[model samples]
Target: MTAHSPSLTPAFWDASIARAEKDSGVKVKQVVAPSTGRDGYAKQLQASGQFPDLLQSITPSQFTDGGLLKPYDQSWIDQNFLLPQGNAIKGKVYVPPTNSQIIPLVFYNKSLFVKVGAKVPTTWQQFLDVNAKLKSAGITPLELGGNDPFAAAMPLTGALSVDVLGKNPQWIQQRHAGKVKFTDADVVTAATKMRTLVEKGYFEQGALNVSYADSIKNFNAGKAAMYPMGSWYLGSIPKDQWNNIGVFPWPSDDGSVVVPFSVGGSMAIASKAKDPAGATKFAQKWSLDPKNLKALIESDGAFPMLKNKTLADYHVKVSPAFTESYTYVTKTNTKVSSMGWATNDEALPGTGNDDFYAAAQALFNSGDVKGQMAKLDKSWDTATK
Candidate 1:
């Protein structure tokens, strides 16, 4: 109800708030966020006083490489934290994302599949086959929100066909890295398949323009059978529609297998925090401490990553398929890349989101495949430089 940044409100802060006040030598104070979005949030911070005990959810480049973060106090971490390595970074912790929600799978209605006498898809070809049947039956096979390019890019996630055809997630990353040519068969073919989905009306009408918020609403409203999203969704969508919710990995060509998903995207403490110890304490509490976890879930319906029993029991309604989906992702042999969308270099280049989106928009909108990619190569070349 308050105007604070939704990000800043994570219950974990309750711990740090307590610690900061007890020490009382320092106060972690901040104005709630702007009415506007991200850019305004950053500008608001830049315009203010000396750094507070913490700056929640800031980019690593600003707080880390820039010497803005004070390396985490390993002592507190050793006592209170549990995480995979490298999370500590060079030193200071900042903000770490803890609870998560489930991402959705684009599933076919089994009733519909049976009526049409079509098998639910297992491989890439099978998925397409199901789509064809759905079209003939006059129930749209998939719902897409093209109104927002961010949402539009989401469906391609299920096409593990690219990974299947290309052979693995590693191959995709290598190619994205310039280590493997973008022209390689795996990347190219994957691009082609995604483009095909667009051509086939696999997504909802006017999808190119759909806002990310509306895209999910449309899916749960039964506008689409499957949506590729995070497990965190379990906490947010309505209970009535909960029964219809089912999950599968972004399916591999054979819907049976999955590319293991790495649990990435947790938060870190800011090196810049005036109260590094307090921030560290908060991050840990925010992660799994009982009081904070309950606050987050009951208030926001966020998913817990800790496997803490208190949180576990609270999530029973949504855990089965949701937890398993995460297991399938982590089950793979591959190590998730250290970063992707999380990286500053990828996101914060000179022209910022504007310049990057211009390229992405061009690629997604271009009707001709070859022309689109050639343009993509040119855009990446410029953007990366």
Candidate 2:
């Protein structure tokens, strides 16, 4: 079995493996994979003919296109999974998602907001007004980590959530069907919004040099008024600072809530496993195991993807920050899959995600929105072919 490390800690894997061994009588060996650039390593293993029986945190199509994965039983998936066919390829479910996470959630420092006399903004214009106030008061409006290219893309993800997906929930599908391009009016609008933030000096100085871990530290220390990140940021907050933090979905144009989320981490079975049946059994058991789900929530603040399950169902103590963000999104009932980090059927094809990240980094540095959008279109066309 392969697992993403650091985020999905070693203890989490140990607990899940212990449960699978006890329940299925199958011994599982774990291999650690980096959270970023995971697909490159998986592909290397595939080329060496040593791909593991079970894989986590990998893009499904990278393996599905090569006929390397075994499809799950649709009936079983339908019975247990909230997103039963999320990562399906041509109507075949290859990967089963384990949880869900809202990306581009704006987590703000409550004390800093109060200090700057800024209220939580519900509309895009109001959000900018808050930022202007923070800037005028000698506080950085936002915290960003651009050195981790994926981290650099979060602000653009928030913009896309409002300017693109909020307008048309099927934007990704439309791009896949060649009905839209990154240079289209809506997409360009999103890019322009991202550029405006940079040009206005909203983000902290040297953000492009900060790593993801360091960004979390800086945010906790109150160097910035807000940090736009995933809901996973909940678990990273220091216990002492929990009461100082609050969260809101990325603001929309008309003040209607639009929370952009995606299936968190998914697992897939290799088609060439020595014991296909045993592998399937272990995958099924591990995915829905209460022990594993509890660990995921406590460690990463991930929402379980199992049907009829709530964060409270785990019976674990979480900070009020988590409860506030979770309750807000659920009550609004306006969740949409984030196109920037999507992993299911809405995922970008081939090298599209990597290209998007690179393009986003360039946009951050140069503020050349149109050039970056054109680059994305070219990259998309090449990747699809």
Candidate 3:
């Protein structure tokens, strides 16, 4: 099978392939993204006159609309597969999702917090109190880079909504369906809280221009006290940074906890796989094989999509903080962003993601939250119509 991905280096891909082949016994042909970027990986694939056996990070719309896919028989995947047990069935079991991953966590710098005598802020009131304490100690409470402009606003667009408003992923669904108003009170409240945090100097100065990547470094560099990101950082961060990192859920002003979804399923097999039958078997093995993922992903803080023993058993032993964050999202019943590949709006590139950024920016600065929402409603109504 030809495997491709962005960001991870060719060496990393080679190592991964070696690991996969050694474990599974099938040699995987690696189709890595260009050394620089994915300017046209898909076109490059077509230009090369061959499609890989698998493609991930390429979304559902691309699968259905790009004509790059050839429909595979689902029954085939089921008969032989083992792991991600059934993430393959987003719609028609078209492809199997390899490893499920989570995103957007609220992690604190333990050393910094200890130095300031701050507790990991569990409650919203505590968050504010902690912010005040950090300011007095001359520590940047939160490190954010907005120079990328929209980077600092994503957590607001994503997590703060669930935390400050309510745990309703459907608002995003409704907005996409043209069922909910973009300027609704829920959106307004989240925006207001985001602004409050910014105005109160919770984030670092010069944040307006900081990049998210740089902000992450700043957090690790001890320039900030807290970092709001996802579990993927668990793997990426250096080991020394681990002791300083403490995970927590997004703090909600409301009684309900903020909800977050692991970005999406990890791997999806192509319909036109050279070894479609073997590929399905590989998918199952990658996800469900206790030897492969169950113990592996859990140790790394990845909450699997499969509810199998790997997660069920490992939850028995974990750091109290990560456990709580996992439990909160679980008990509250987290959901994926409906406007993402899960729904129709994803068909329009830069439409949903771009529109959300604008809405978040407006809500952050505006005095009249509902009025801001009202404007969004009018615009959304026009766009959909």
- Candidate-wise lDDT, in order: 0.49, 0.81, 0.57
State how far residue 18 of model 3 sits from its true place (Å).
5.8
Candidate 3 residue 349 Cα shift, in angstroms, is 6.9
Give the poorly placed runs of model 3, Cα more than 4 Å off: 1-29, 35-39, 43-49, 66-90, 93-95, 158-160, 163-166, 273-275, 286-350, 358-385
Q: Give the per-residue Cα lDDT of candidate 3 at 72.
A: 44
Against the true structure, candidate 1 reaches a TM-score of: 0.73
**Per-prediction tally of clashes:** 49, 0, 14
State the weakest 10-residue window (summed lDDT) of model 3: 339-348
Q: What ranking of all candidate models by lDDT puts the best one first?
A: 2, 3, 1
lDDT by residue (tens digit), candidate 3, 53-82 = 766445544555555554445664455343
Sorted by TM-score (best first), the order is 2, 3, 1
Q: List model 1 lDDT by residue over 73-145, tens digit each.
A: 4554444433322233433344343444322244333455565687656677877777787777777677656
Please name the candidate that would achieve the greatest TM-score relative to the true structure: 2
Among residues 3 or more apart in sequence or in different chains, the pairs in candidate 2 whose N, CA or C atoms overlap within 3 Å are none
